[model samples]
Target: TGGSNAFAAPEAFQTRSSSRPSPPPRPDLSSLASSAAPEQHAVSSVPEQKAATEAGVLPLYKIALCCLLTDLKINCRDSLLVSRAQAPSLPGYLDLVEALQQRVAAAAELKDVAALCSVFSGFLRNSLLPSSCSPDVQVRLLHALAEVGLDQRRE
Candidate 1:
């Protein structure tokens, strides 16, 4: 019983497969050669392709703020469906706002964009300065923040 139960030998596995047909030979490389300079065109297309990619990606903070703003706006305007979205996750919402402010501040001349800055500043203040924090306060504060980012467009 022990001899019969012994595991198959390694040679047995390899020898068993020998009866199968071998794979076909690889194609001849010389016949596949082409004159097309795909590399040249690829190099030329890199920058344009990169810019197009960047154009497609809006700043995430701006998008999140836009979503939060829209949520607030719909609730205010009495649009039932849009207003029903779950409230923005607080930590994520705050981090997004902070990131947006930092990004905007770094990219723009703060002095020249004072008025625009104030709107965001005010929104941040309202979100923090209130004695009792509620979803309503957060929503209103976000509208003010969204307005600040939007205001930058006019200037």
Candidate 2:
């Protein structure tokens, strides 16, 4: 006898959502979601060198390519788009990369704190901060660098 209720199948059918658009994101939920995550604008901002690092290709080589691109007044951001597989085929970057590596090795060999700092500053200026970046970008990049304080070690 209860099997007669089987005709209720139509009533159990779900309402179609096509007639109604979803509600817009609520400000509170949006703010909370944002708070739980990083400031995307800040996080996604490349600040010159980051774009290359994010490419996740031949890290140092691509990073140097980004730097070299900036030197040629080319936007390094484009170089960051190259895939890792294709990174070797771009140009003859090994020489430049090797020279930079040598400079890094030289810096690593330094026993003097001042010399090490000079090399680090040089890296920050020439490698990290591209000349093509706008002054505001430079300031933004410097602001990030400014957070560090060199520890005092007895000479």
Candidate 3:
């Protein structure tokens, strides 16, 4: 037979050509560390609380509680639900409810409905519905959401 043998000698093997390109050189971060200014470190290392205060941002949980109180007021006004009484018995609820009560009372005392509305809107935009809220609270929140939708449609 004129055909070449299927089994070649071991010495006849050849390396396959690689399609991948050589990897780029690694960056020299050691030089960057040595050259970084103290001011850069100071700015980067600012404490989160200090940064938040400077930016006039409230803590997320407080904002959520404020939104919840606003929703309760809008939907449960006839019930005259007390913030403390309505708050679900859960960790952190007491402090949040108390803070919300104080804020609402202060707003009412100042007779600043516009400011109260603004704060409520701000909080609502940032708020999250807590998984621990009672079914009653959830239903009230749904009603509040529907009211908001109707108001938006009217406007």
In terms of TM-score, the best-performing candidate is 1
Q: How would the candidate models be sorted by TM-score, starting from the highest?
A: 1, 3, 2
Q: What Cα-based lDDT does every candidate model obtain?
A: 0.45, 0.35, 0.42
For model 3 the local lDDT of residue 117 reads: 37
* Candidate 3 lDDT: 0.42
Off by over 4 Å in 3: 1-34, 38-40, 43-56, 59-63, 77-99, 104-155
Counting clashing residue pairs in each candidate, in order, gives: 0, 0, 0
- Model 1 lDDT tens row, 43-101: 54776777665545334324433443444443433322233364344554555456455
Candidate 2: C-alpha lDDT: 0.35
What local lDDT does model 1 show for residue 116?
31
- Give a tens-digit lDDT track for model 3, residues 40-119: 65544457656656445444434444656655544443333344355333334334444445654444222223333333
- Could you arrange the candidates by lDDT from highest to lowest? 1, 3, 2
lDDT of 1 at 93: 53
Q: Candidate 2: where is the Cα deviation over 4 Å?
A: 1-106, 109-129, 150-155
**TM-score for all models, in order of appearance:** 0.29, 0.19, 0.26
